[model samples]
Target: MSDQPPYTWWPAGLRRAGAALGVLGVQWYNAARTNIGATATSTVFEPFVTTALAGAAYARPFVRFAGTGTWTLGRAHFAVGDRSAELLAGASPPGEGTYGYTVTRYTNEAHKGNGLYRDLTLELVEVTNAAG
Candidate 1:
């Protein structure tokens, strides 16, 4: 048998596959753009609140779109169930609140230098009382 390094093209193929896998993951995250967060003391995580208020409800079955959002003190990170999602926003634990916090969406990465992160902000205006 000829000794041609036994499949020299394996590494490249693997790399391409890995890249494709990464893209798939990111796309899944983008499409599942459901941002859910809540207070630390609270055991419930509410994603619907943001969706209803942020006008993202119509965007259900979230498309694989790149975007960015800012987080303040009262808010927590976007979480899928109990697992906090990286694609969504995160909280700074608990502390004083900030003004003018918003989360802006983007279609083109060039819009923001970060590409993935857009200049956005969010605020937690209404906090309903926990059921007794």
Candidate 2:
């Protein structure tokens, strides 16, 4: 018999669900920007799935950044939710639009036994202008 824990398959299952339902993407930054135009030293383009917060209006769009692994974050720029956008260091974030979002809050779910995070959910709020 295998010595692996029964929960070992959980991460793969979650990843599959994310791939199927994750139509949105966000530019994840390793450091917090003091303002919108500030330069980011490091960034990664990651795909994500979005949902409305419970008991919240549609205007307040919420997205969750789920992965089979852990991540470090300081700020995120989500404009248009376009999975095709190329995010580069020093490049400005996308312009304001219907789905433009800013990370307002986040919660991390990590495995206590292994200290590996399984999910990182970022709560997003809509951006109304380019100054965000």
Candidate 3:
């Protein structure tokens, strides 16, 4: 390993940069055998912006999270958009009590946003069935 000096984006800088992207975000749980992680069971979320899928716009809902670092994978999740007005947790929104999307795919997207994209883009697709 070559000796080098640490710079801004080494660690703390990343967290600071992440704050800017914390405009609209999503919250979810790990939904795994080991119910342990960043926000262990109560409620955890990450900064993200929802986008309409390019071609399959209606069919697919696209969400963009951090470009890099600490990605928690879970079967179930809740999305609260609309200026954090609507909240749906685990296949149900408020009184609905049952209805959500299954995470079919989680992808890492790369584009010319190192300055803005931070690290990369995270794309998640939801399925018909409920996930949790």
Candidate 4:
């Protein structure tokens, strides 16, 4: 008496197609390289907190991009998911170092297993206003 059905894992593989929407699909933009907004559906909570803590000082902005991107990361890059380049609050700065951002942490946190998909999280670091 096998508890398995006719197809055990077949139902789970269907989600990969929808998940890999940006394998060869989307192109992440690099501002310093070309001056455009792009990349994954990344998060920016820490940056926000940092900025908020600064109150009214001088702190650089942080950007986030997360989603499914087949775009390769150079020394710097992002993971984006659409054709139209949309800019975030403090993204695509005028120049690097003037107010630059970097990936402080990157993690492949989870896998849906519902498809050919894997979950990822990347933490970005940036300057924010000072308490003084």
- CA lDDT, every prediction? 0.24, 0.34, 0.28, 0.28
Writing each residue's lDDT as its tens digit, candidate 2 over 43-131 gives 12342333222232212112334334443333344434432224332344455235678899887877446663354556768777876
Instruction: Itemize residue pairs with steric clashes in candidate 1.
Output: 77-90, 101-121, 101-122, 102-120, 102-121, 102-122, 103-121, 104-120
Error of 1 at 33 (Å): 23
List all candidate RMSDs to the true structure.
21.4, 16.5, 17.1, 19.1
Residue 28, model 1: lDDT of 15
Candidate 2, after superposition: displacement of residue 19 in Å? 7.8
Which candidate model has the greater lDDT, 2 or 3?
2
* Predicted candidate 4 versus true structure: per-residue lDDT over 9-72, tens digit per residue: 0101112233332111112223232323222222222111110121222112222224644433
Q: What is the lDDT of residue 25 in candidate 2?
A: 27
**Which candidate number maximizes lDDT?**
2
lDDT (Cα) of model 3: 0.28
Residue 85's lDDT within candidate 4 is 27
Ranking by lDDT: 2, 4, 3, 1
lDDT for model 1, on a 0 to 1 scale? 0.24
lDDT of 3 by residue, 8-98 (tens): 0011122334422222222222323221212111111432223222222111212333345553332222332322222222223322454
Tell me the number of clashing residue pairs for each predicted model: 8, 0, 2, 13
